[model samples]
Target: MPTKSTRVPTHASTPVKRRPGGRSARVQDAVYSAVGKLMATQRPDQITVPMVAELADVNPTSVYRRWGDIDALLEEVAVAAFTREDEVLPDTGSLEGDLREWARVITDDIVRPHRTRYLRAMVNARDGVVLDACPCWTARREQLAEMISRAHTRGERTPSVEQVLDHVIAPLYHHVVFALPADTAYAERLVDDVLSMRSAESR
Candidate 1:
């Protein structure tokens, strides 16, 4: 087994340019970047389109017209941010290793710049909207599909998406959402417990 590396990854993800429609793409990038800058120091609720626009050097009308409101902008930015994060999830040989490594990386992300804004976006996501509406959720599923497929290649079965989320991912998110102090050790324990339960259930 490959021992876990102690290297802490910097969570400063580059903002993706969303919306590929020419000037629209530029506008989206500027808006997303503006929101990211604000989110670094202020909660999403504490930010306004005017504030974002002033920081982005765009017209407030453009911000309002494109995103409609601060809530939508934050959501979009959150999804974009998560996409960047997910792009780095490693493909370790074992499903357990893959998840444990993923969890450890995100455990460090809990303290990154603008971490609170993204966590609030994720926790508040399912309150009134479809959880799948968030691009981050979709990105995670797609990544899992690939991960699971790799496990199958090694003749190993993997947990269902729901199981993975409920047992592993959700618990880590809880730490962030609740502002609890947890490190990757918490992630390893959570994964170990969940895998143990799954093994017991299978027997």
Candidate 2:
């Protein structure tokens, strides 16, 4: 994981250029939806570009052209599915409340059966290649940065974004990936732990 001082890279592998809106948006949505449906019944290895193309009612060439291969497609789909880009950030008048709500929302989302499968599939698709940047991770980091900034503006002492990611967000996903319990209590504990780090620093 990159530290607070280190800049994160902007792309995973090669940057995939996607055309936004109109037919392009529709096709992308269809393909993403197809991948989700397939993941419900089949493992990541069992799914193929052709299967997705057929299910999505789009040409295989379209999938190939836009996403390259099945693994790439799966990665893109997982990134899209995992990040809540459209939602508003949690602002509960304090950094603690924001972190707890954010963690709770994440825990609730990733603990679902389908989401767990998607996460596993995304990991498997990586095939051991360490990415300097992942869209999903970047999105979460950006959200955290915003939340942290808000807290700063409100005169609340808070942990660095990296600290939050390391102590809270990372552990939540770690538990999910490892099939460990990542319940509401676990998320709340993580929030408390990270907040405690700030208190410890102040002391």
Candidate 3:
């Protein structure tokens, strides 16, 4: 439960190095770093390959060669941000505890800062031709589904796993990240309410 001041790292972009694996890896790193920094200030729609190339000090043609288009570049940035191993929920042998930790992690990591940026990125992707093509949404949906499945296995949730996924967890994430209220006490209350519902169903 870190305060807002202490929560976000000053440098939000976790830049990966140009891997020596090959030229493609290096070029991709350049593209991701460039897009990530730009995303910090501007919405995803504002990011273009030329803008990224200028920021990364690479040729716009080079950026296009690696990523094809702005949508592709933004997709890569979303995958890197959302699908990282650290973003996955821990099993923790108890659904309630695991979900509590999950909520807290998301609250601090994704919701603390740049909430609008992340939400706008999703919106932009959805309104474009690259909706299903984005791996970020796919991975996150799978992760959420898996968490619900684990709760079902433990007999910790009711009204079907799909119900909880749709009505409970999904809505909570939407509320916390997209419609971020200035008052986080409400966020905590939502988390607690979800956890309590699962606990009650378990018994």
Candidate 4:
């Protein structure tokens, strides 16, 4: 039997801090846009801080002061691009429905060409950082926790967070990172497999 994967960290260990508005926000937005545009035409490995600063029309020092390094900037940009901060979590009245809808949304988003590029860029930017340290992974884990909490309140049988991460989330990301097929059906199947664990536990 496969041992359960460790729980993903609920939050980033070192969150990026920035002033909300005024000149600082503008500069950050420009830098993020510059990175997005560059990633469209250039590999993340080839892009440099100077290149980003030049494209954003900001001084190289500003980029460095804000993000410190090209890899850090890329990771931040990728995280910002991937997360929908304003979007509400699915509340479909059941864990199965919620997971299916959530999985479908994730499958649709990550499988897009631009998102695929960002996912690849995020992976390259990490070097060898554990998944627990990744802001993107932490965000997804938090979302999953919220959904699972709702299920628990409703007295629904639910799989542990580790089981969901291992059976559902991990497989989807594996397919994506490996350039294999990861469609809505595949995502839903993973959800089904994880939910089966809940059934097994009850039996």
Candidate 5:
């Protein structure tokens, strides 16, 4: 938690260190907030750097210095926003239910103009830094592993985490990114297909 004075205060005074939980963190929070606020009513193309700077009460140079360009900022902010939503993996007592829910949410996000814009930007990030910066990537894989572990405990045949990702989750991501149709039914079927397959060539 941040103190009242440090909770997104203007940086016209002394500069804050860009470390986690510092003034720099507050600035990031404010900027993300400003982006969210603007995104609710406007399309991604309509959002400008100066507009975000104004909404965030920070300098345009600051925004430019940290994120490079509007599209870059959108990518970072969008990843952060979506990452927060999946912090708690779904557990509807069955893996199929959980997979379906996750797929629906992702599919819906992909169709949203604003969310998709940032996702596309991230997909084009050749440096591969954005995915590493996002906690969601690792956490999501872990959640899937946990789900498999639970099924194994129930005497059900289970695949490894990598198998699940490769056969199930990765396909859904491919569909969404490539603009293919992947609805809830498709999501459930993919999960079922993967889960039913034999692992380690034992079949």
Candidate 6:
């Protein structure tokens, strides 16, 4: 835990150590990795620079000089976690099939103890603003929308792909992330509901 005297670094003060040489970006990545591991177990409020430094096996001064404070460090950590390879979007031919795959992929991640803990923390802290701000959100949503568009190209549904994404799949996913029971069957049911909605809309 940071002491009162340990000032939280301003967002501006938390300069990313990215330089033209790439040396600083590497260092910044290491720090963010350490913080991600910590976030798996601890809430953002409990994360500290010393703990991150210890995990990265770098001196505390290096952490401070690079990231400035724990909050900035935490933000970077969240960003890195979001961009990790496990979250990459997959392509399948059909909208329903793709959505089922997406639901499975998403739930598999959310059901993990580490990720669920972090997600629960974010949800409890406030509506999923932290997750929403992640760059991956836009990227993943776009990919999903593209999948939905492919369904439209096939004449699979009446509502536009964007409507399905915004109304059905997105809301279901949000519930899965923030509120729904994290069961495989439950996830499948959500996918079913989205597909049913699409079919009805088409009718």
The 0-to-1 C-alpha lDDT of every candidate, in the order given, reads 0.68, 0.78, 0.57, 0.76, 0.65, 0.57
Report the C-alpha lDDT of model 2 over 1-203, residue by residue, as the tens digit.
Answer: 11221111111222223436578767876887888889889988899999999999999999999889999888777776655434568999998998899888889989988788888888888886987766677778888889989988999888887788889888888899889999989999989988878443365
> What value of lDDT does candidate 2 attain over all alpha carbons?
0.78
Error of 6 at 194 (Å): 2.1
Question: Among all windows of ten consecutive residues in candidate 2, which has the lowest summed lDDT?
Answer: 2-11
Give the winner by lDDT: 4 or 5: 4
Candidate 4 stretches with Cα past 4 Å from truth are 1-19, 198-203
Model 1: CA > 4 A from native: 1-21, 122-134, 199-203
- Candidate 1: clashing pairs of residues: none
- Candidate 2 Cα errors over 4 Å, as ranges: 1-19, 198-203
Top candidate, metric lDDT? 2
Decide which is better by TM-score, 2 or 5.
Answer: 2
Worst 10 residues of 5 by lDDT: 1-10
TM-score: model 2 vs. ground truth: 0.84
lDDT of 3: 0.57
- Tens-digit lDDT track of model 6 for 26-143: 5655665676577667876687788889897878998898668666655544434333333445567677777777767666766676665555444444533544343435445566
| Pairs that clash in candidate 2 | none
Cα-based TM-score, every candidate: 0.80, 0.84, 0.68, 0.83, 0.68, 0.66
Q: Kindly list the per-residue Cα lDDT of model 3 for residues 84-203, writing each as its tens digit.
A: 543446788776566556655655655645644755576666663644333444554566668767877886653334444554456655765566452345445555666556443345
Residue 106 in candidate 1 has what lDDT?
66
